[model samples]
Target: MKYFAVFLPMLNEEKSKQYRGDHIAYLEEMDKKGKVYAKGRFTDGAGGLVIYIAETFPEVEELVKQDPYVKIGAREYEIHEWDMKVTEN
Candidate 1:
């Protein structure tokens, strides 16, 4: 199963900046574990978004919960299980 995590950095830019390093580290770990598929921030002056491919929704949820952004209350996330039918190589 695949999961899509829609992360919205709340009005806590300062906190996000403070924890950015830890957050990136956590994301790198996830990538190494082959759990992350595609991830990027909303460079449109918005928030961020991340997509993960996992064994289950619970696994993805736990992963998201471990993010420094979420832990530090700098961002909140909404997760949805996905059924992807197409992709660009």
Candidate 2:
């Protein structure tokens, strides 16, 4: 599996709040499926990040498209394949 990072910049704060619960739920669902590596928000509140485990870019892209925040236009995102040269042991 490859790591795919979805860098989501907050767009509509109100909309985001409205769907925040659903968003987290979706991530948790994915995590249970072993589809998510990690997810977090920036302290500045400017955006958030979700690292996904997938075999192909399209798989991650599809996951992102299914995100509640993305589906509702509460956030804008760019998906990048992470190099991940280092990590905690």
What's the lDDT for residue 20 in model 1?
Answer: 83
What do the candidate models score in CA lDDT, each in turn? 0.81, 0.96
- Model 2 scores worst on lDDT over the 10 consecutive residues at 80-89
What residue pairs clash in candidate 2, if any at all? none
Instruction: Determine the backbone clash count of candidate 2.
Output: 0
> Relative to the unseen true structure, what is the C-alpha lDDT of residue 22 in candidate 2, on a scale of 0 to 100?
98
Report the C-alpha lDDT of model 1 over 1-89, residue by residue, as the tens digit.
Answer: 66675565565888988988998898899899888887888876466888887888788888898888998888888888777778779
The C-alpha TM-scores of every prediction are 0.86, 0.94
Q: Model 1, poorest ten-residue lDDT window?
A: 2-11
Error of 2 at 63 (Å): 0.3
- Candidate 2, residues 3-58: lDDT per residue as tens digits? 99899999999999899999999999999999999999999989899999999999
lDDT, model 1, position 86: 83
lDDT of 1: 0.81
Q: Would you list the clashing residue pairs of candidate 1?
A: none
